[model samples]
Target chain A: MAQSNGTDVRLMKGNEALAEAALRAGMQAYFGYPITPQSEVMEYLTMHAPEHPGVVILQAESELAAINMVYGAAGAGARVMISSSSPGISLMQEGLSYMTSAQLPALVVNVQRGGPGLGTIQPSQGDYFQAVKGGGHGDYRLIVLAPASVQEMVDFVFDAFRLTEKYRNPAMILADGALGQMMEKVALPPVGSLPRSAAPWATVGKPATRERNIVTSLFIQPERMEQINLQLQAKYRTLEKEEVRCEQLQMEDADFALVAFGLTSRICQKAMELARQKGIRVGLIRPITLYPFPSAVIRKAAGQVEAFVTVEMNAGQMVEDVRLAVDGTRPVHFTGRMGGMIPTPEEILAKIEAVVAEPSLQHA
Target chain B: MKEPDVIEGMEVVYRKPQTLTATPMHYCPGCSHGVVHKILMEVVDEMGIQDKTVGVAPVGCSVFAYDYMNVDMQEAAHGRASAVATGIRRVLPDTYVFAYQGDGDLAAIGTGETVHTVNRGENILMVFINNGIYGMTGGQMAPTSLLGMKTSTSPYGREAAVNGYPLRITELLAQLPGAYYVTRQSVHTTAAVRKCKKAIEASFRYQTEKRGTCFIEVVANCPSGWKMTPNEANDWLEKNMFPYYPIGDIKAPKQ
Candidate 1:
């Protein structure tokens, strides 16, 4: 097979790239329940998974059970993954909390759809807080990656696995349904040659040389529990330093910049392109890693920019993080679309131009 | 005076306890969870598949069954152990997989999961524990609680008009073609415990032999929930729960 730069380019949807990337990343097992827009991930895995030895794919009874199975396989030192949409991911929060507290490394993909309750399943980025914040309970955080395109979807899966093992924590690819179902050109990573090592802490049953190992997060003593939390917090600090990733575009001389991530980022990028062509000094800061968020970069950019306009598919989740990063040095404006409706580049351009035109908003 | 020769009779040999290290059980005293755990471990030991066996434990009194079974164990969400087991088995076909669940967990909130798993003909074993009432949550009314049975949630006794009748999961699952073996056994007495062991072993064997889904529903007594002494609860199970949830092979592969 001919390869371009040793990677094969293929047209695929965000969901398809996730499945392909997971399999190529040595993910031997997948347990997921089917939900709209994101169901294609399960469908693809179901059709193709049995061809590979050690690869397991199952349509679980619910998102709750699927994530627990991920916990089981991850405990066994297997590269396991699961995928679902907004409400489905909500159902999985309890198990995800357990996985977090237990410090198991696994991958969870959330193809967000609209929801407060059983919302429509077209496309929405309503799970912003749920993905970056602990989503579940307790004092814990997940390594969240946002993929804006099919190529990033493929790349993020491999990165998620590597980071998960490196940190011994759960990682999430927070894509909305728009990215999940949309088709785009993606260069697939090579199946072999990728790193495939489990953490020494993983429980894969005892061998003759070692004593039995137990993987649990429960601590009866408050001091021990506090110690564990401190340890986890230290790990998070290390991750924050090493894993922050983002994409900066045209921010150097711009009067204002649009901050976005995932599919919304793509729209913002396009809007910035259109605005620049019209002589408007607008730029974009698209975050690639939602957790370990690129706060420092935003802080530096805020020094030169007049204002930061945060655009998202949800009402206002990531906006909070953006505001915190700016630290009130500059005004941070917000605009969003919920219930699976996506904002077009034209709409974002309008929002950006409106913010730039307002005299009071420009300097203060 | 010559002291009698004191000899410690040859030091007794103690085998490693056959329980999983993943869980430390929180089962109540005299709960049938211990018996069920022993039976499953004995089967794994006898079959020489301890290293290749994966068990899924559900919520309820038996939620911690993983803690006491010496094998790869997964603790599943309430009522969803079977679905989790299905995922494990699909990925590791050579590994013997089973789920241990309780009445309220499997037959109530998880009813759809259980029925659909069985209907899909998942080649996994299901060990259903029917203890008449919910044990972990302070004796709440369970799907298996009989009519006129009082519980914390059903203080006036489970009136047929209000609470609906008890669910017979074995008979219900046996109707599906995907089920290769379906049996209801008990652990109330010595003979019943033996029978339950046999049923559990049969279910495991069916999965090993690549048969369809094998389901064994064990009619157990929860003295804590029944508000009786262990012996009285066993006797109560014999008199009250047994007839409604009869013990027999609803479907079994031909010998």
Candidate 2:
């Protein structure tokens, strides 16, 4: 096994980059099932696990089993992760609910494809609402990171683990089929950079020195369950306040804005340039953390921009959040392609032009 | 004093193991879940692995097995205990891990996880408590419910046409190569209790050898769920359940 002297660079697929980055970030175990657009993640880990001793990678029978395995490993104080595509992720919602209720920290990578039911193998942001708005039962939030490129995919693996462990909650890297399949240069984190932290609550067997550890989400009493829900809500509030992150691209004197994320955000950046060439004065706001959403930034921009156009590869999922942030002050228009369709810059630019060219907006 | 009379000459016949916590279990009187919990903890206590063992509790009557078992424990979702044990065992390979599940949890809802975990040869003990009914949910029919068993769901007694035949999951699991040790034991009799204790101890020992999955099916009784008194439930189990379940080892490792 060759040692990593910090600079381990490779042109890798987005899913592969995430897997390598997870291993480099000192992930202790990975349990996953095969799902299209993300199968390479486990494949890469299974092939490279020999190079990284002390890491356990197993292909589980199903997504439900994979997530529960993650739940168990995380409860046992292991840095663990699981990855799957959209439909498989849907199957994991029950386990995710259990994980969040137990307050176990683990990483879930959703390489999203089109959805509703076995939608398509192509990339889609249809799961944005699912990721941000409690896809599972119960009141819980997963710290969601949207990576637009393979490099961001590599970088956010460490960030997701850090956030999940720091807050003692589950975190998700919401990638799409496009970003998962695309190849780009990524600088993997140095080996052994992220050491396992001490988990006082982990069920690692109770020595006499400490009280026995019990990991569970079951609260038989209604008052006790309410108290746990209150605690989780409080944590979510802190996440919203402190963890909101986004890229404000060229908003310095803009009259209009384009709100997008992940792969669609890259397309929006191109559309912004196209709109700018037409004297539209459009800027792009790319949300990196979807859960602790960059609402404050979008609200601030709402005061300056005449209108906002949310571009997505789904049927206007994130547009709802953008509208909520804009708060009816400005018309937040939406243009999207659904069922595994990718929105072109020209199509998004047309929507932006129509929103700006509205007689009401022209008068304002 | 009355307490001091012949105290020194008395030999201890029975005592609650230290591994069984002082927390009184919530199981109904004569429910065999408590009995299984007692002997399982006894194994952990006698083996001196209470600190080295981790238990995964299922969602049925023993959902709070963590409360009564004084080891590091985790409560899993309804049927996912075996999968949860797999995660724990894989992460801490040397830790003695076991998943305690019930009839519905193991044979029905969690059958996939149970089968796959065994098939993968996950080095853990799976303690399945087959009460032939869903005890926690008010006496619903379980997959292992006898063909003519009556329950809340099976009001007219289970019929193969409507309810399907009982599943012999323990025997089915024994056929898998990953199942290194598979056995069926009961706790209705003093002799049966001893055999069940031995089975649990053997499963824990097999875990140390890294052989494969060790499974113990305790043909337990649910007095409250069956609407019977403790003695009646025990008698019923002996007469009716044993004929079908047949307490004995189904598979064992070669010498």
Candidate 3:
């Protein structure tokens, strides 16, 4: 409900807004390493965080150290966060997996750049599979959220912290280099108190009244560990039902629909406008939650639309999810740019037009 | 020396520190982790900081420290316990925090974390256990393994040309301006155990003084890993380990 106006909004990069909003959302600590594009998150926080009381900002020695520091802070019952980019995030997968098994709530930001391994600093959604499909080694999922704008980047910091507490699982704001670097006017969340019950399993000290709280991911006993895994899976099931977030535009009698998210979705929004002007009857379904992924809406769209086209900054990573959502009800087509390339609106528009022309491209 | 008079119907000593849990430790004979864990717990209990103490366990044989130490603990991945301890100490500033790590975990794989944590002056105690071999992972040659030492990984006695030299990590860390106390002691003998315990308590005390990181490296012996009996390991350690990782303080805070 908070909106940016002349008084409340100031044009800022997505990374800056994310940092500011996290502080406002009661983040007690920020631990991170400097990495390309994403480094601005820590930079902005370091510059502004001293103004906020009780906030601890630390520049970690490495991404490995940063994420583990987040693990420690999260275990200590602090509202903690960490930010990094692709190769850096790769370095953090072990720590992330530890947090997952521990079931600690942490807000992590990945201003992703190109990488199979340290590919480029340019924006790319190559990490979509990594974010939603458990980049860390575990039968777990990071509640992945894709923010398409500076506003959502700001807004989702609050959303991410809340969802993390609600499920007690790590939540990632999967933005790419463009969203992190682009400047826009954004309204930040007001300072609010996190509910005490958020981290019931946190390792607060053993006082006279409360028992000692131990936070760990190591479950050596096989049977009990399996039970914990099942319990985590159950919570994930609840999240899939409850946390599927998406935005639909111009679906009224649309014969063709475009599916994308984050930066690609914003590009698709422009492509949709261009397609509508050219009478293509194209619409958009912007998946706000990449993990739970708005599959129900896509299923609904599949009933009405003749075909679906997915645009992404990666080489057809998310198209697989769209296919599963449509489930052979209709045809699906994918077009993408990889290795740090961002596809333009005209390029996306041409792809959508081509999908509409070829009837046999349905199963693709 | 005479034993203190005992009072009837009163337990003079708790026997074990209250901070040590009832669960039995899985450390092998002469591994020194059990002795280190016991002494650390004793220090925590004696300091009356049991309720506010948090321990970060490293990924090695002692990763299961959480099961034995009564205090709240978080298990860090291999070589990141210092960073993890730093985070916890920052959040719970008033809480006494320490990281328990092995030579391979600290001196080798975690060298960066161990050095930088000391360099950053984080107010946490770092308990480094330098037993010449990697005990948990089948007695591999550790960074602190002696120049002529032979183990599973180095079946042919370690040669300086092939394996480099044993690392004097405490000496390396002593040069850091942020390190308030960098001491090397062992737990192989009763006298050494007492000195090691004193060093640990001193390091924990410095956390409250708001001084920089206190690194206490305990040069211990691993009998099973070294293919020696407990007494033989201690004798071998005295003959070989001490010459390389000599006892006594490498650096100390200003008096």
Candidate 4:
């Protein structure tokens, strides 16, 4: 059953749940350019926004326009959001950076697809690095959340908006094509009463006694820019300690560990199940927050496991983080299924077995 | 003998607007940005909406617009001012929103945002400063750089084949039904400043009335970038740039 605080449970696509959850999280506006795997988000809002009073929905000419619109709305102190796929996400990188630097709170859902260019409409984990690390120019971080299920997609967007406001920083819900399109039971929470115009920092206009608020990142002075960067870095450090999240599964007694997130985490769950049934002790570490990267859990797992195998739908993007968490102490191997390819549970189970059985790694 | 005063009464012809801060702008001497900035703030003060106005500044010299304008302001990335303004207007439809941008920002890199924001008929004012060359990034050639004009990037004079043609953006935008008001003015002369100020005032009123997109293009002079004295730059602008970019209303709000 779906769960979210005495709300009705319904089977929904990840994208649809995201839209509903945004409404529940008190979204003032949603601006987006449609792309595969995430178009339903805009579609859902366009169809249902009339029923949700006071919520604004607009389709931008492009991702570039959509992101800038979000920046403007967020700067005005409106809780806004935008969603697109890989190629479209690439177009928004500049605006995303601006939003972060300007210290505007926003939500961006990048339902990743295969790409270095307009590669494919199918699912891929290629944007892990872009989402966790700085996607745009400059030194910045997006509070990155990776949702493994449709239910999680619903929950994470709400969490993202909360974290976005709490820190006054942009948060990214980095899902993939598989998760966005997949159907699962999701709980629709009660409608939030916080109005978009209620943002204390928002520019509803200057009042008689209040000072004007300027939302900008331009620091012409080198020292001032450095100070802003230092401040951002300090906030990031605090977030890392307070926000790191991961789900450890069947890790009590295991010789091998599978590190993955999003759809790959679901695949790893089955792989762990398959390995356990075959008398092979394997655990799964599903990182929910990619930025505050569940490194401590990996560090703890290093003492329990002899080897680590990271499985991804991309060319092993998240594996690099896995390796860093393991810190070269344990054998961290990778198996990628890119260009829309998915790793099967049996395949991942075999890869785990091979990690302990062989000196050289085996490909999936 | 009565204490004789040289002047019995002094009249105040002009005063800085309360909408503008006392902070000295970083604009170079003889730059049109200062004039354009003054007129806009004057409109804000005259309308008595300083608290209800939000300005979006471009990534060029006016990126520090927040430092000068005593209203809530946002600094947009190069060319995305219109897009940002659209967002603000959409959410806070009651508030007055405007974007201050340079030619490079409005015509070249930000061309898409500029065109689309106008085309959407967003209730925002766009004050475009067409200086013909990139000001903040030194004397680089811009999309509005005139034919045969020499820039740092176009050192041998702008060749239409190599450097491309100067884009008359406001004129082109006149074709869109969404842009209810489109005007091209200058900031060099006192008479022109008054006209521009009235145009800005009219536009601000239309914005409050929820009229469509209102665009005002100011053909400004750039002394430092053009390698001319402030006086020479004004003369050159009137002689050369004026003939090419004549000031007038390209379109007026639909009746």
Estimate the TM-score of every prediction.
Answer: 0.90, 0.98, 0.96, 0.95
Q: In terms of lDDT, which candidate is stronger, 2 or 4? A: 2
Q: lDDT by residue for model 3 over A1-364, one digit each (tens)?
A: 3354533567889998899888888899999999998888888899988889779999999988888899999999998999988888889899888898888889989999997886999999999999999998879999999999999998898889999888889999999999999999786646674443556566766665665677888888999899989999999899999999999999886889999999998888889999999998998999999998888999999988989999999889889999999999888899889999999999999988888778674554
Q: What is the TM-score of chain B alone in each candidate?
A: 0.91, 0.96, 0.94, 0.95
Better of 2 and 4 by TM-score: 2
Could you say which candidate leads in lDDT? 2
lDDT of 4 by residue, A75-102 (tens): 9888899999999999999998888888
- Judging by lDDT, tell me the better candidate of 2 and 3: 2
Fraction of true contacts retained by every candidate, in order, equals 0.20, 0.88, 0.77, 0.83
Task: Determine the TM-score of chain B of model 3.
Answer: 0.94
Best DockQ among the predictions, by candidate number:
2
In candidate 3, list every pair of residues with a backbone clash. none
Q: Write the per-residue lDDT of candidate 1 for residues B150-252, one digit (tens) a residue.
A: 9998998999889888888789899999999999988777888888878877877778688689999888989888888889988898899888988889998
Residue by residue across A1-364, what tens digits does model 2's lDDT show? 2335657778888988899999998899999999898999999999999999999999999998999999899999999999999999999999999998999999999999987798889999989988999899999999999999999999999999899999999999999999999988777777877766789999988898988999999998999999999999999999999998899999998998999999998999889999999988998899999999989999999889888888888888899999999999999999999999999999999898888779998684
Could you tell me which 10 consecutive residues in candidate 3 chain B have the lowest summed lDDT?
B1-10
- Which CAPRI category fits model 4? medium
Which model, 1 or 3, shows the larger DockQ?
A: 3
Model 1 lDDT per residue over A49-161, tens place: 77666688877767876886787677666788999988899998987887777788889999888888999987888888988888887888999999888888899999999
lDDT of all predictions: 0.82, 0.92, 0.89, 0.89
CA error at residue A308 for candidate 1, angstroms: 0.7
Question: What interface RMSD do all candidates show, one decimal each?
Answer: 3.1, 0.5, 1.1, 0.9
C-alpha lDDT of residue B56 in model 4: 93
Best candidate according to TM-score? 2
Write model 2 residue lDDT over B1-255, tens digit each, in one string. 113324578866667887888898899999898889999999999899978999999998899998999999999998999999999999999999999999999999999999999998899999999989999999999999999899999989999999899999999999999999999999988899999999999999999999999999999899998999999999999888889898899998886
Off by over 4 Å in 2: A1-6, B1-11
